[model samples]
Target chain A: MSYSDLYRNAMEKATARDAWKAETIEKITAMQSSHKKNTSVRHICFTAFRHSMVPLASAALIALMFFYSKNDFLSPSLSDSSNNTPYVAAFSANDTASIQEQTAPIGRSRSIAIFPNIVEAPTPEQALPSDSCSLDDAVVSTEQYDQAVALLEAQLMEQSQDGTLPVVLTKSDIVAQGYFSANDTISVVFALPATSMGENLYYVYEIPLI
Target chain B: MEAILSPADAVEVYGNMVFRAAFGIVKSQQDAEDIAQDVFFSLVRTNPRFSSAEHQKAWLLRCTFNRCNSYFRSAWHRHTTSLEDYHNLPFTPEETYVLDTVAKLPVKYRQVIYLHYIEGYSTAEIAQLLHRNQNTILSQLSRARTHLKTSLKGDF
Candidate 1:
């Protein structure tokens, strides 16, 4: 066969898959419409807020911290040094010490706050009553708990400005083991939601009171 | 110049051509389909104006070729590959034989041969689409034809 004949034969056969063409067109249309909608300011803002809830929360916390720090709402008595163990110091001494150790090189500004935000403690059924208990152990009403959680979340957003997304502590994610009055500390355990790339980190914080 | 055809109409007219151009170089149907989608997606996003239908087709073909080259250059594609076999193509035995022969040619020759013989694009057109000197395209086409002639001695 001549090259001309071969070209004719090959051209005749080199067609795209029928099913793929239909599927592709459908996908393109869907993407175009979604892209159109996604470009709107409201849609973009909503999508961003939905996807980066953790980051947003962290930002709010940082802003609130700046406000509190500037106004002396969070006194020096409740600073990181007042606590016997710093959160980072404790984290660095544990098995996952590397997580905190790596932060030093990143040069992120760090601060610790003792929030008096939580007005209620865990109930007796939820927490063990210690001999030094002075505050009443009561389950906070859902509304009060939510308000306190929002305040704490805002505080956390402030703490995250150093670019560390430490466990995103939210009301839903926290398990309040109750407050200890002896050292004026509130112990809480929380887990960070898995990152977009699927990394999950758990954390515990013992917030002190002035 | 403003685009002569709508995005959907352009894709309908030139999608197969774009797919074939991409498939000619990549030797992968799935990758070719992806390149076609990207070409149209870019068209919709950029809404570039073309002087005529022929200009639009050439532009689409050029984009397909560039995307295919980029796919080959990508480290991820280089490290991991799951290419579809030539025999598995939906073509008659003779057509498969021709394509398999074409696929075996060097990358430069493969593109020149496809555009020249199958797609019926002239050497000058191919060079312009690829942004190469016409002499370079002519040289690649000559080398490709010789290789095909030798590989399919009796068939040619």
Candidate 2:
């Protein structure tokens, strides 16, 4: 027989084999009935769940917005538009008082002069006495102030004797001793106290070699 | 078109159809029955309106096939013995041996053969039910015939 015919014959035999048992059919039918019941209920439940999700999410979003707005209103320091108005009024009033005090007649308070000390110059004799006092105090004290002055003076004398304080030696001093060498730079950071509004003040300074 | 089929009528008419389709793929009567029930339950739960009786029938068959395929992939299914034993039970002696033999074939070939022959589906119908191309159904059917021929050679 040809391959096609043989194939057809095999198929026919395989299919003609048997009917399913009665007990099996009954069992399947019962299962189908129960499954139908369960699926119907499950689908209804799923639909209900889906419907509720939208309202739940909306409620959550509304609650979040309400709480956030409430928090903003409660904080006295937040500086909302309304809150800043009073602060601006108080600042302007203070500015006006300060202006009055600054422009008042000099006769009202001798301390109010802008250049109070510019007209007063110490006599040469007074300058000589103050300089001697500072020098004598430095020489006689056994404190750290005396030690620092003595060290500075010794360094200056040694520098003068070396005629330019050795170029390579100055470079080394700049790197190690942080002194007044060609390459030396000084950095200073000034940290002020925190303001009442909880912000800090910072100043950074970079001083190049002279 | 008409009001939905009552759960009772659906069970009476389509239960066997669904079961056979499930059995064709799963091989075991128990798993097939379970799949059949699940399909009917899904139908009742979804309450999807059908255009005609034919559409309902096709839907059940499709659902049954899907459930059976899911059963095959389940962890429990992998550990179970071959569903060949389902037909070997002490019921319906004449047909039992034949079914047992068919069940012994690999799942891929056996499913196409059962749908084509026992379920009386056309190649195109089987392809649609299994969500396969017509060529794939044809090839599987051809392979199944070859396997059955060798298996049933002396007995037939």
lDDT of each: 0.54, 0.44
**Model 2: per-residue Cα lDDT at residue A18:** 32
Model 2 over residues A33-144: C-alpha lDDT tens digits? 4344433433443233234443443344343334323323222222132211110000111111111112212111111111111112222232222212111001111232
| Deviation (Å) of A145 in candidate 2 | 77
Interface RMSD of 1: 12.0
Runs of candidate 1 exceeding 4 Å displacement: A34-210, B1-3, B154-156
In model 2, the clashing pairs are: A32-B37, A35-B41, A36-B41, A39-B45, A40-B45
Proportion of true contacts reproduced by candidate 1: 0.28
Q: What TM-score should be assigned to candidate 1?
A: 0.50
Identify the leading candidate in terms of DockQ. Answer: 1
Question: Where does model 2 exceed 4 Å of error?
Answer: A1-210, B1-4, B82-94, B154-156
